[model samples]
Target: MEISGIGSFLRNRRFGNYLEASFGVNFASPSKVAVKEEVEKKIQSVAFVEDDGIGAVLISWVRIVVCFVTMMFTTFIWALIMLVLFPWPYQRIRQGNIYGHLTGRLLMWILGNPIKIEGSECADEKVIYICNHASPIDIFLIMWLTPTGTVGVAKKEIIWYPLFGQLYFLANHLRIDRSNPSAAIQSMKEAAHTILKNNLSLIIFPEGTRSKSGRLLPFKKGFVHVALQTRRPIVPVVFTGTHRAWRKGSLHVRPAPLNVKYLPPIRTDDWTADKIEDYVKMVHDVYVKNLPESQRPMH
Candidate 1:
Protein backbone atom coordinates (compact mmCIF):
# COMPACT_ATOMS: atom_id res chain seq x y z
CA MET A 1 0.00 0.00 0.00
CA GLU A 2 1.13 3.56 -0.74
CA ILE A 3 2.20 5.66 2.29
CA SER A 4 -0.65 8.18 1.68
CA GLY A 5 -3.23 5.38 1.87
CA ILE A 6 -1.54 4.13 5.05
CA GLY A 7 -1.96 7.63 6.56
CA SER A 8 -5.75 7.43 6.10
CA PHE A 9 -5.78 3.92 7.52
CA LEU A 10 -3.86 5.01 10.61
CA ARG A 11 -6.28 7.94 11.12
CA ASN A 12 -9.27 5.55 11.20
CA ARG A 13 -9.94 4.60 14.82
CA ARG A 14 -11.62 1.34 13.97
CA PHE A 15 -8.92 0.31 11.52
CA GLY A 16 -6.14 1.36 13.91
CA ASN A 17 -7.73 -0.58 16.80
CA TYR A 18 -8.17 -3.64 14.59
CA LEU A 19 -4.57 -3.40 13.41
CA GLU A 20 -3.30 -3.19 16.99
CA ALA A 21 -5.42 -6.23 17.90
CA SER A 22 -4.09 -8.12 14.86
CA PHE A 23 -0.48 -7.21 15.71
CA GLY A 24 -0.97 -8.42 19.29
CA VAL A 25 -2.54 -11.67 18.04
CA ASN A 26 0.15 -12.34 15.43
CA PHE A 27 3.13 -11.38 17.66
CA ALA A 28 3.68 -15.04 18.67
CA SER A 29 2.99 -16.28 15.11
CA PRO A 30 6.31 -15.15 13.61
CA SER A 31 5.75 -16.84 10.24
CA LYS A 32 2.49 -14.96 9.41
CA VAL A 33 3.15 -12.80 6.28
CA ALA A 34 -0.10 -10.75 6.75
CA VAL A 35 0.93 -9.78 10.28
CA LYS A 36 4.40 -8.66 9.11
CA GLU A 37 2.90 -6.45 6.36
CA GLU A 38 0.36 -4.83 8.78
CA VAL A 39 3.08 -4.09 11.37
CA GLU A 40 5.32 -2.53 8.72
CA LYS A 41 2.46 -0.34 7.43
CA LYS A 42 1.61 0.95 10.94
CA ILE A 43 5.25 1.84 11.60
CA GLN A 44 5.49 3.76 8.33
CA SER A 45 2.28 5.68 9.08
CA VAL A 46 3.48 6.62 12.57
CA ALA A 47 6.82 7.83 11.19
CA PHE A 48 5.11 10.04 8.60
CA VAL A 49 2.86 11.68 11.22
CA GLU A 50 5.86 12.27 13.49
CA ASP A 51 7.86 13.87 10.66
CA ASP A 52 4.97 16.18 9.64
CA GLY A 53 4.35 17.25 13.24
CA ILE A 54 8.03 18.06 13.73
CA GLY A 55 8.18 20.04 10.50
CA ALA A 56 5.13 22.14 11.51
CA VAL A 57 6.69 22.93 14.89
CA LEU A 58 10.01 23.89 13.29
CA ILE A 59 8.32 26.20 10.78
CA SER A 60 6.31 27.91 13.52
CA TRP A 61 9.50 28.53 15.51
CA VAL A 62 11.33 29.95 12.51
CA ARG A 63 8.48 32.37 11.76
CA ILE A 64 8.32 33.51 15.39
CA VAL A 65 12.09 34.09 15.49
CA VAL A 66 12.04 36.11 12.30
CA CYS A 67 9.20 38.32 13.58
CA PHE A 68 10.92 38.94 16.91
CA VAL A 69 14.30 39.85 15.38
CA THR A 70 12.83 42.23 12.84
CA MET A 71 10.59 43.95 15.40
CA MET A 72 13.51 44.40 17.82
CA PHE A 73 15.79 45.80 15.12
CA THR A 74 13.27 48.37 13.92
CA THR A 75 12.25 49.43 17.42
CA PHE A 76 15.91 49.78 18.46
CA ILE A 77 16.78 52.09 15.58
CA TRP A 78 13.66 54.19 16.15
CA ALA A 79 14.39 54.55 19.86
CA LEU A 80 18.00 55.55 19.16
CA ILE A 81 16.87 58.27 16.80
CA MET A 82 14.17 59.56 19.18
CA LEU A 83 16.62 59.63 22.11
CA VAL A 84 19.26 61.46 20.10
CA LEU A 85 16.71 64.03 18.95
CA PHE A 86 15.38 64.53 22.51
CA PRO A 87 12.67 67.20 22.33
CA TRP A 88 12.08 68.90 25.74
CA PRO A 89 10.27 72.27 25.62
CA TYR A 90 6.60 72.69 24.62
CA GLN A 91 7.57 73.47 21.04
CA ARG A 92 9.87 70.47 21.11
CA ILE A 93 7.07 68.58 22.81
CA ARG A 94 4.84 69.26 19.83
CA GLN A 95 7.61 68.05 17.58
CA GLY A 96 8.09 65.01 19.81
CA ASN A 97 4.38 64.23 19.68
CA ILE A 98 4.59 64.40 15.93
CA TYR A 99 7.52 62.03 16.10
CA GLY A 100 5.47 59.73 18.30
CA HIS A 101 2.69 59.61 15.75
CA LEU A 102 5.26 58.78 13.09
CA THR A 103 6.77 56.15 15.33
CA GLY A 104 3.34 54.57 15.80
CA ARG A 105 2.87 54.49 12.06
CA LEU A 106 6.30 52.91 11.62
CA LEU A 107 5.55 50.29 14.25
CA MET A 108 2.36 49.31 12.46
CA TRP A 109 4.36 49.11 9.25
CA ILE A 110 7.00 46.88 10.81
CA LEU A 111 4.37 44.57 12.20
CA GLY A 112 2.33 44.67 9.01
CA ASN A 113 -0.55 46.20 10.95
CA PRO A 114 -2.58 49.41 10.57
CA ILE A 115 -4.12 51.71 13.19
CA LYS A 116 -7.07 54.06 12.74
CA ILE A 117 -7.45 57.16 14.94
CA GLU A 118 -10.75 59.00 15.38
CA GLY A 119 -12.29 61.87 17.37
CA SER A 120 -9.45 64.30 16.76
CA GLU A 121 -12.07 66.89 17.74
CA CYS A 122 -10.50 67.32 21.16
CA ALA A 123 -6.88 66.29 20.80
CA ASP A 124 -5.95 68.86 23.44
CA GLU A 125 -2.61 69.00 25.23
CA LYS A 126 -3.67 69.09 28.88
CA VAL A 127 -5.73 65.96 29.50
CA ILE A 128 -5.64 62.80 31.61
CA TYR A 129 -5.92 59.62 29.44
CA ILE A 130 -7.63 56.46 30.70
CA CYS A 131 -7.36 53.35 28.53
CA ASN A 132 -7.93 49.60 28.76
CA HIS A 133 -5.17 47.11 29.61
CA ALA A 134 -4.14 44.71 26.85
CA SER A 135 -0.37 44.45 26.62
CA PRO A 136 2.83 46.52 26.58
CA ILE A 137 1.41 47.64 23.26
CA ASP A 138 -1.05 49.70 25.32
CA ILE A 139 1.77 52.08 26.20
CA PHE A 140 2.87 52.26 22.57
CA LEU A 141 -0.72 53.00 21.54
CA ILE A 142 -0.85 55.78 24.11
CA MET A 143 2.38 57.14 22.73
CA TRP A 144 0.88 56.79 19.28
CA LEU A 145 -2.07 58.92 20.35
CA THR A 146 -0.55 61.49 22.70
CA PRO A 147 3.00 61.96 21.50
CA THR A 148 3.25 65.20 23.44
CA GLY A 149 5.11 63.59 26.36
CA THR A 150 2.52 61.81 28.48
CA VAL A 151 3.56 60.36 31.84
CA GLY A 152 2.50 56.69 31.68
CA VAL A 153 1.59 54.78 34.85
CA ALA A 154 3.23 51.36 34.44
CA LYS A 155 4.31 48.43 36.65
CA LYS A 156 7.61 48.70 38.54
CA GLU A 157 8.57 45.18 37.39
CA ILE A 158 9.06 46.31 33.78
CA ILE A 159 12.20 48.16 34.89
CA TRP A 160 14.10 44.87 34.61
CA TYR A 161 13.13 44.08 30.99
CA PRO A 162 16.48 44.52 29.20
CA LEU A 163 16.62 47.36 26.61
CA PHE A 164 13.00 48.54 26.77
CA GLY A 165 13.32 48.79 30.54
CA GLN A 166 16.19 51.28 30.29
CA LEU A 167 14.32 53.30 27.69
CA TYR A 168 11.13 53.36 29.81
CA PHE A 169 13.13 54.59 32.80
CA LEU A 170 14.78 57.25 30.67
CA ALA A 171 11.33 58.46 29.58
CA ASN A 172 10.60 59.22 33.25
CA HIS A 173 7.44 57.10 33.08
CA LEU A 174 5.40 56.61 36.24
CA ARG A 175 6.05 53.27 38.00
CA ILE A 176 3.46 51.69 40.28
CA ASP A 177 4.02 48.94 42.87
CA ARG A 178 0.55 47.44 42.99
CA SER A 179 1.53 44.82 45.58
CA ASN A 180 1.81 47.67 48.09
CA PRO A 181 -1.22 49.97 47.97
CA SER A 182 0.57 52.64 49.97
CA ALA A 183 3.48 52.55 47.56
CA ALA A 184 1.03 52.67 44.65
CA ILE A 185 -0.70 55.69 46.14
CA GLN A 186 2.62 57.42 46.57
CA SER A 187 3.54 56.51 42.98
CA MET A 188 0.32 58.10 41.73
CA LYS A 189 1.05 61.22 43.76
CA GLU A 190 4.52 61.44 42.31
CA ALA A 191 3.09 60.88 38.82
CA ALA A 192 0.67 63.78 39.30
CA HIS A 193 3.55 65.94 40.45
CA THR A 194 5.53 64.98 37.35
CA ILE A 195 2.58 65.92 35.14
CA LEU A 196 2.19 69.39 36.70
CA LYS A 197 5.96 70.00 36.84
CA ASN A 198 6.57 68.95 33.25
CA ASN A 199 3.11 70.17 32.09
CA LEU A 200 2.90 66.71 30.50
CA SER A 201 -0.15 64.59 29.68
CA LEU A 202 -0.91 61.25 31.38
CA ILE A 203 -2.06 57.78 30.30
CA ILE A 204 -3.37 55.24 32.81
CA PHE A 205 -4.42 51.65 32.14
CA PRO A 206 -6.71 51.34 35.17
CA GLU A 207 -7.27 47.60 34.89
CA GLY A 208 -3.65 47.22 36.19
CA THR A 209 -2.90 44.29 33.88
CA ARG A 210 -3.73 42.90 30.46
CA SER A 211 -7.21 41.31 30.40
CA LYS A 212 -6.92 37.85 28.86
CA SER A 213 -10.50 38.05 27.62
CA GLY A 214 -10.28 41.57 26.21
CA ARG A 215 -13.10 42.55 28.55
CA LEU A 216 -12.57 45.63 30.72
CA LEU A 217 -11.83 44.36 34.17
CA PRO A 218 -12.48 46.38 37.31
CA PHE A 219 -10.25 49.44 37.25
CA LYS A 220 -8.05 50.66 40.07
CA LYS A 221 -9.02 54.11 41.34
CA GLY A 222 -5.47 55.49 40.90
CA PHE A 223 -6.23 57.28 37.65
CA VAL A 224 -9.37 58.72 39.21
CA HIS A 225 -7.25 59.78 42.19
CA VAL A 226 -4.79 61.49 39.87
CA ALA A 227 -7.53 63.23 37.96
CA LEU A 228 -9.19 64.54 41.12
CA GLN A 229 -5.85 65.26 42.78
CA THR A 230 -4.50 67.25 39.85
CA ARG A 231 -7.94 68.67 38.95
CA ARG A 232 -6.99 67.85 35.35
CA PRO A 233 -9.49 67.06 32.61
CA ILE A 234 -9.68 63.33 31.83
CA VAL A 235 -9.73 62.09 28.23
CA PRO A 236 -11.10 58.63 27.50
CA VAL A 237 -9.25 56.71 24.76
CA VAL A 238 -10.76 53.48 23.50
CA PHE A 239 -8.58 51.00 21.63
CA THR A 240 -9.82 47.92 19.76
CA GLY A 241 -8.19 44.98 17.94
CA THR A 242 -4.77 45.36 19.57
CA HIS A 243 -5.20 42.16 21.57
CA ARG A 244 -5.68 40.28 18.31
CA ALA A 245 -2.46 41.76 16.90
CA TRP A 246 -0.25 41.06 19.93
CA ARG A 247 -1.81 39.39 22.94
CA LYS A 248 -0.17 38.66 26.28
CA GLY A 249 2.09 35.54 26.35
CA SER A 250 2.04 35.50 22.54
CA LEU A 251 5.25 35.98 20.53
CA HIS A 252 3.96 35.95 16.98
CA VAL A 253 2.87 39.41 15.73
CA ARG A 254 -0.36 39.11 13.79
CA PRO A 255 -1.34 41.76 11.28
CA ALA A 256 -4.62 43.42 12.23
CA PRO A 257 -6.14 46.89 12.12
CA LEU A 258 -6.09 48.84 15.39
CA ASN A 259 -8.95 51.28 16.00
CA VAL A 260 -8.54 54.24 18.37
CA LYS A 261 -11.31 56.63 19.36
CA TYR A 262 -10.42 59.68 21.43
CA LEU A 263 -13.44 60.83 23.35
CA PRO A 264 -13.71 64.37 24.76
CA PRO A 265 -12.03 65.23 28.06
CA ILE A 266 -13.87 64.41 31.31
CA ARG A 267 -13.68 67.48 33.52
CA THR A 268 -12.63 66.76 37.12
CA ASP A 269 -12.78 70.21 38.74
CA ASP A 270 -16.19 69.45 40.21
CA TRP A 271 -15.65 65.69 40.48
CA THR A 272 -14.57 64.06 43.75
CA ALA A 273 -12.43 60.99 44.39
CA ASP A 274 -15.59 59.29 45.66
CA LYS A 275 -17.02 59.58 42.15
CA ILE A 276 -14.08 57.75 40.56
CA GLU A 277 -15.84 54.43 40.39
CA ASP A 278 -18.60 55.94 38.27
CA TYR A 279 -16.09 57.53 35.87
CA VAL A 280 -14.19 54.30 35.56
CA LYS A 281 -17.35 52.39 34.69
CA MET A 282 -18.34 54.98 32.11
CA VAL A 283 -15.04 54.68 30.24
CA HIS A 284 -15.01 50.91 30.48
CA ASP A 285 -18.50 50.77 29.02
CA VAL A 286 -17.48 53.03 26.17
CA TYR A 287 -14.59 50.72 25.35
CA VAL A 288 -16.78 47.63 25.40
CA LYS A 289 -19.33 49.21 23.09
CA ASN A 290 -16.73 50.52 20.64
CA LEU A 291 -14.67 47.32 20.48
CA PRO A 292 -15.27 45.14 17.43
CA GLU A 293 -17.18 42.00 18.37
CA SER A 294 -14.99 39.72 16.30
CA GLN A 295 -11.77 41.00 17.86
CA ARG A 296 -12.85 40.66 21.47
CA PRO A 297 -10.67 37.99 23.08
CA MET A 298 -12.27 34.76 24.28
CA HIS A 299 -12.87 34.50 28.01
Candidate 2:
Protein backbone atom coordinates (compact mmCIF):
# COMPACT_ATOMS: atom_id res chain seq x y z
CA MET A 1 0.00 0.00 0.00
CA GLU A 2 3.04 2.26 0.28
CA ILE A 3 3.97 3.85 -3.08
CA SER A 4 6.84 5.92 -1.73
CA GLY A 5 9.42 6.67 -4.42
CA ILE A 6 6.87 7.21 -7.17
CA GLY A 7 6.46 10.80 -6.06
CA SER A 8 10.08 11.62 -6.83
CA PHE A 9 10.32 9.29 -9.84
CA LEU A 10 7.13 10.54 -11.50
CA ARG A 11 8.15 14.12 -10.80
CA ASN A 12 10.94 13.62 -13.29
CA ARG A 13 8.31 12.41 -15.76
CA ARG A 14 5.90 14.53 -17.87
CA PHE A 15 2.69 13.18 -16.31
CA GLY A 16 3.74 14.94 -13.13
CA ASN A 17 3.49 18.22 -15.01
CA TYR A 18 -0.03 17.24 -16.08
CA LEU A 19 -1.17 16.82 -12.46
CA GLU A 20 0.82 19.84 -11.17
CA ALA A 21 1.34 18.47 -7.63
CA SER A 22 4.70 17.77 -6.02
CA PHE A 23 4.98 16.34 -2.54
CA GLY A 24 8.53 14.99 -2.36
CA VAL A 25 10.00 16.32 -5.56
CA ASN A 26 13.75 16.88 -5.13
CA PHE A 27 13.40 16.80 -1.36
CA ALA A 28 16.40 15.97 0.77
CA SER A 29 14.48 13.91 3.36
CA PRO A 30 10.76 13.65 2.71
CA SER A 31 8.35 11.71 4.86
CA LYS A 32 7.16 8.39 3.32
CA VAL A 33 3.64 8.88 4.65
CA ALA A 34 3.44 12.34 3.12
CA VAL A 35 4.52 11.04 -0.26
CA LYS A 36 2.01 8.19 -0.13
CA GLU A 37 -0.79 10.54 0.83
CA GLU A 38 0.05 13.01 -1.95
CA VAL A 39 0.34 10.23 -4.56
CA GLU A 40 -3.13 8.99 -3.65
CA LYS A 41 -4.43 12.53 -3.72
CA LYS A 42 -3.00 13.09 -7.21
CA ILE A 43 -4.40 9.81 -8.56
CA GLN A 44 -7.85 10.57 -7.18
CA SER A 45 -7.68 14.06 -8.70
CA VAL A 46 -6.66 12.62 -12.08
CA ALA A 47 -9.57 10.21 -12.02
CA PHE A 48 -12.20 12.71 -10.87
CA VAL A 49 -11.21 16.18 -12.10
CA GLU A 50 -9.88 16.64 -15.64
CA ASP A 51 -9.96 20.44 -15.48
CA ASP A 52 -9.53 23.07 -12.75
CA GLY A 53 -12.95 24.74 -12.70
CA ILE A 54 -15.86 26.12 -14.72
CA GLY A 55 -13.55 28.58 -16.47
CA ALA A 56 -11.37 25.70 -17.60
CA VAL A 57 -14.41 23.75 -18.73
CA LEU A 58 -15.55 26.79 -20.68
CA ILE A 59 -12.12 27.10 -22.29
CA SER A 60 -12.14 23.44 -23.25
CA TRP A 61 -15.53 23.79 -24.87
CA VAL A 62 -14.37 26.93 -26.65
CA ARG A 63 -11.32 25.09 -28.01
CA ILE A 64 -13.48 22.20 -29.12
CA VAL A 65 -15.98 24.52 -30.78
CA VAL A 66 -13.38 26.64 -32.58
CA CYS A 67 -11.52 23.64 -33.90
CA PHE A 68 -14.68 21.90 -35.09
CA VAL A 69 -16.00 25.10 -36.66
CA THR A 70 -12.71 25.66 -38.42
CA MET A 71 -12.63 22.01 -39.46
CA MET A 72 -16.18 22.13 -40.86
CA PHE A 73 -15.37 25.12 -43.03
CA THR A 74 -11.89 23.75 -43.68
CA THR A 75 -13.39 20.55 -45.00
CA PHE A 76 -15.66 22.45 -47.36
CA ILE A 77 -12.74 24.63 -48.38
CA TRP A 78 -10.59 21.63 -49.30
CA ALA A 79 -13.49 20.03 -51.09
CA LEU A 80 -14.04 23.12 -53.23
CA ILE A 81 -10.32 23.63 -53.81
CA MET A 82 -9.76 20.07 -54.90
CA LEU A 83 -12.90 20.06 -56.96
CA VAL A 84 -11.83 23.17 -58.85
CA LEU A 85 -8.39 21.70 -59.49
CA PHE A 86 -9.72 18.31 -60.48
CA PRO A 87 -8.80 18.91 -64.11
CA TRP A 88 -5.21 19.74 -63.25
CA PRO A 89 -2.50 17.15 -62.58
CA TYR A 90 -3.30 14.87 -59.64
CA GLN A 91 -0.09 15.87 -57.85
CA ARG A 92 -1.42 19.39 -57.48
CA ILE A 93 -4.42 18.07 -55.58
CA ARG A 94 -2.29 15.66 -53.54
CA GLN A 95 -0.16 18.53 -52.29
CA GLY A 96 -3.13 20.74 -51.51
CA ASN A 97 -4.06 18.74 -48.38
CA ILE A 98 -1.74 20.94 -46.34
CA TYR A 99 -4.83 23.09 -45.81
CA GLY A 100 -6.17 20.30 -43.62
CA HIS A 101 -2.88 20.13 -41.72
CA LEU A 102 -3.24 23.82 -40.98
CA THR A 103 -6.47 23.04 -39.13
CA GLY A 104 -4.44 20.56 -37.09
CA ARG A 105 -2.03 23.34 -36.24
CA LEU A 106 -4.95 25.44 -35.05
CA LEU A 107 -6.07 22.61 -32.74
CA MET A 108 -2.56 22.17 -31.34
CA TRP A 109 -2.12 25.86 -30.67
CA ILE A 110 -5.53 26.37 -29.08
CA LEU A 111 -5.19 23.23 -26.97
CA GLY A 112 -1.87 24.73 -25.80
CA ASN A 113 0.21 21.58 -26.41
CA PRO A 114 3.45 22.59 -28.03
CA ILE A 115 5.10 19.91 -30.16
CA LYS A 116 8.74 18.99 -29.79
CA ILE A 117 9.46 17.02 -32.93
CA GLU A 118 12.84 15.37 -33.42
CA GLY A 119 14.25 14.34 -36.81
CA SER A 120 11.17 15.67 -38.66
CA GLU A 121 13.51 16.26 -41.57
CA CYS A 122 13.24 12.56 -42.25
CA ALA A 123 9.68 13.07 -43.47
CA ASP A 124 11.20 14.35 -46.71
CA GLU A 125 12.26 10.88 -47.79
CA LYS A 126 9.92 8.39 -49.45
CA VAL A 127 9.46 6.14 -46.45
CA ILE A 128 6.87 4.79 -44.05
CA TYR A 129 6.39 6.77 -40.82
CA ILE A 130 4.90 4.45 -38.17
CA CYS A 131 3.52 6.14 -35.05
CA ASN A 132 1.91 4.80 -31.86
CA HIS A 133 -1.75 5.77 -31.41
CA ALA A 134 -2.93 7.23 -28.09
CA SER A 135 -5.50 9.95 -28.95
CA PRO A 136 -7.74 11.35 -31.73
CA ILE A 137 -5.55 14.43 -31.60
CA ASP A 138 -2.93 12.10 -33.05
CA ILE A 139 -4.55 12.63 -36.44
CA PHE A 140 -4.24 16.41 -36.25
CA LEU A 141 -0.73 16.28 -34.78
CA ILE A 142 0.50 14.18 -37.67
CA MET A 143 -1.40 16.26 -40.19
CA TRP A 144 0.50 19.30 -39.00
CA LEU A 145 3.73 17.45 -39.72
CA THR A 146 2.79 15.43 -42.80
CA PRO A 147 4.43 16.76 -45.97
CA THR A 148 3.75 16.83 -49.67
CA GLY A 149 3.62 13.44 -51.40
CA THR A 150 2.87 11.87 -48.03
CA VAL A 151 -0.45 10.02 -47.79
CA GLY A 152 -1.73 8.68 -44.48
CA VAL A 153 -3.42 5.34 -43.71
CA ALA A 154 -6.47 5.40 -41.42
CA LYS A 155 -9.33 3.10 -40.44
CA LYS A 156 -12.62 3.13 -42.34
CA GLU A 157 -14.63 4.26 -39.32
CA ILE A 158 -13.01 7.69 -39.49
CA ILE A 159 -15.92 8.80 -41.68
CA TRP A 160 -18.14 9.08 -38.64
CA TYR A 161 -15.98 11.63 -36.81
CA PRO A 162 -17.67 14.86 -37.85
CA LEU A 163 -16.11 16.92 -40.62
CA PHE A 164 -12.66 15.74 -39.61
CA GLY A 165 -13.36 12.38 -41.19
CA GLN A 166 -14.83 13.90 -44.31
CA LEU A 167 -11.80 16.15 -44.68
CA TYR A 168 -9.52 13.11 -44.31
CA PHE A 169 -11.28 11.25 -47.11
CA LEU A 170 -11.42 14.37 -49.27
CA ALA A 171 -7.66 14.69 -48.84
CA ASN A 172 -7.19 11.45 -50.77
CA HIS A 173 -5.81 9.47 -47.82
CA LEU A 174 -6.20 5.68 -47.83
CA ARG A 175 -8.66 3.90 -45.52
CA ILE A 176 -8.21 0.29 -44.41
CA ASP A 177 -11.13 -1.90 -43.25
CA ARG A 178 -9.77 -3.68 -40.20
CA SER A 179 -12.96 -5.66 -39.62
CA ASN A 180 -12.30 -7.82 -42.67
CA PRO A 181 -8.93 -9.54 -42.99
CA SER A 182 -9.25 -9.94 -46.75
CA ALA A 183 -10.15 -6.28 -47.10
CA ALA A 184 -7.29 -5.15 -44.83
CA ILE A 185 -4.70 -7.15 -46.75
CA GLN A 186 -6.02 -5.93 -50.08
CA SER A 187 -5.97 -2.38 -48.73
CA MET A 188 -2.31 -2.70 -47.70
CA LYS A 189 -1.34 -4.10 -51.07
CA GLU A 190 -3.01 -1.18 -52.77
CA ALA A 191 -1.29 1.15 -50.29
CA ALA A 192 2.06 -0.36 -51.26
CA HIS A 193 1.40 0.16 -54.93
CA THR A 194 0.26 3.74 -54.34
CA ILE A 195 3.45 4.52 -52.42
CA LEU A 196 5.59 3.21 -55.26
CA LYS A 197 3.57 4.72 -58.07
CA ASN A 198 3.21 8.19 -56.62
CA ASN A 199 6.60 8.28 -54.87
CA LEU A 200 4.78 9.17 -51.67
CA SER A 201 5.55 8.57 -48.02
CA LEU A 202 3.05 6.66 -45.86
CA ILE A 203 2.07 7.49 -42.29
CA ILE A 204 0.26 4.82 -40.33
CA PHE A 205 -0.55 3.98 -36.71
CA PRO A 206 0.60 0.36 -36.56
CA GLU A 207 -1.09 -0.12 -33.20
CA GLY A 208 -4.35 0.58 -35.10
CA THR A 209 -6.31 1.96 -32.10
CA ARG A 210 -5.55 4.56 -29.49
CA SER A 211 -4.38 3.16 -26.12
CA LYS A 212 -6.88 4.28 -23.49
CA SER A 213 -4.49 3.32 -20.65
CA GLY A 214 -1.62 5.24 -22.33
CA ARG A 215 0.47 2.05 -22.77
CA LEU A 216 1.73 0.74 -26.07
CA LEU A 217 -0.48 -1.98 -27.49
CA PRO A 218 0.69 -5.06 -29.37
CA PHE A 219 1.46 -3.73 -32.85
CA LYS A 220 -0.49 -5.04 -35.79
CA LYS A 221 1.62 -6.36 -38.72
CA GLY A 222 0.19 -4.30 -41.58
CA PHE A 223 2.99 -1.75 -41.38
CA VAL A 224 5.63 -4.47 -41.47
CA HIS A 225 3.94 -6.00 -44.49
CA VAL A 226 3.88 -2.64 -46.29
CA ALA A 227 7.51 -1.96 -45.42
CA LEU A 228 8.59 -5.36 -46.72
CA GLN A 229 6.51 -5.05 -49.86
CA THR A 230 7.64 -1.51 -50.68
CA ARG A 231 11.20 -1.68 -49.29
CA ARG A 232 10.71 1.74 -47.70
CA PRO A 233 12.53 2.74 -44.55
CA ILE A 234 10.40 2.75 -41.37
CA VAL A 235 10.55 5.79 -39.11
CA PRO A 236 9.31 4.96 -35.64
CA VAL A 237 7.43 7.86 -33.99
CA VAL A 238 6.67 7.94 -30.24
CA PHE A 239 4.30 10.47 -28.68
CA THR A 240 4.49 11.19 -24.94
CA GLY A 241 1.79 12.59 -22.62
CA THR A 242 -1.01 12.75 -25.20
CA HIS A 243 -3.30 10.26 -23.44
CA ARG A 244 -3.66 12.55 -20.43
CA ALA A 245 -4.31 15.58 -22.61
CA TRP A 246 -7.42 14.24 -24.40
CA ARG A 247 -8.39 10.81 -23.12
CA LYS A 248 -10.59 8.29 -24.95
CA GLY A 249 -14.06 9.39 -23.74
CA SER A 250 -13.15 12.74 -22.20
CA LEU A 251 -14.97 15.76 -23.64
CA HIS A 252 -12.46 18.42 -22.63
CA VAL A 253 -8.91 18.66 -23.97
CA ARG A 254 -6.47 19.29 -21.12
CA PRO A 255 -3.26 20.74 -22.43
CA ALA A 256 -0.03 18.91 -21.67
CA PRO A 257 3.57 18.93 -22.82
CA LEU A 258 3.86 16.62 -25.83
CA ASN A 259 6.97 15.24 -27.50
CA VAL A 260 7.03 13.46 -30.86
CA LYS A 261 10.38 11.99 -31.76
CA TYR A 262 11.14 10.50 -35.14
CA LEU A 263 13.69 7.86 -34.32
CA PRO A 264 16.29 6.92 -36.90
CA PRO A 265 14.78 5.15 -39.85
CA ILE A 266 14.92 1.32 -40.07
CA ARG A 267 15.92 0.07 -43.48
CA THR A 268 14.01 -2.89 -44.91
CA ASP A 269 16.46 -3.95 -47.61
CA ASP A 270 17.89 -6.77 -45.50
CA TRP A 271 14.51 -7.87 -44.07
CA THR A 272 13.18 -11.21 -45.32
CA ALA A 273 9.63 -12.51 -45.48
CA ASP A 274 10.50 -15.49 -43.31
CA LYS A 275 11.48 -13.15 -40.44
CA ILE A 276 8.24 -11.17 -40.33
CA GLU A 277 7.68 -12.05 -36.69
CA ASP A 278 11.17 -10.90 -35.76
CA TYR A 279 10.70 -7.76 -37.82
CA VAL A 280 7.44 -6.86 -36.05
CA LYS A 281 8.93 -7.37 -32.59
CA MET A 282 12.07 -5.44 -33.53
CA VAL A 283 10.06 -2.41 -34.60
CA HIS A 284 7.82 -2.76 -31.56
CA ASP A 285 10.85 -2.61 -29.26
CA VAL A 286 11.97 0.59 -30.93
CA TYR A 287 8.80 2.34 -29.71
CA VAL A 288 9.11 0.76 -26.24
CA LYS A 289 12.57 2.15 -25.71
CA ASN A 290 11.70 5.62 -26.98
CA LEU A 291 8.53 5.93 -24.84
CA PRO A 292 8.31 6.85 -21.17
CA GLU A 293 7.93 3.96 -18.67
CA SER A 294 4.36 5.09 -17.99
CA GLN A 295 3.49 4.47 -21.63
CA ARG A 296 5.44 1.27 -22.26
CA PRO A 297 3.84 -2.18 -22.28
CA MET A 298 3.48 -3.83 -18.84
CA HIS A 299 5.16 -7.11 -19.83
TM-score of each: 0.67, 0.79
Model 2, span 1-299: residue lDDT tens: 22222322322233333223322232233685565465455433433245668898789889988877877776787778766665553443354445634566666766765444556656557889988888878877776666556788888888787766765666677888888878898889998988887787898989888898889999988998898889999988788878877888987788665677788889999888899889999999888888999999998
| CA lDDT of every candidate | 0.62, 0.72
Candidate 1 at 191: error in angstroms? Answer: 1.0
Q: In model 2, which regions exceed 4 Å deviation? A: 1-51, 87-89
Which pairs of residues have clashing backbones in candidate 2?
Answer: none
Q: Quick one: best TM-score, which candidate?
A: 2
All models, RMSD in angstroms: 20.1, 11.6
Per-residue lDDT of 78-178 in model 1, one digit per residue for the tens?
Answer: 55655754654333344334434544434444454344456755655678888876754665666555635555668999889875565555555668877
Cα-based RMSD of candidate 2: 11.6
lDDT (C-alpha) at residue 53 in model 2: 82
Candidate 1 has an lDDT of 0.62
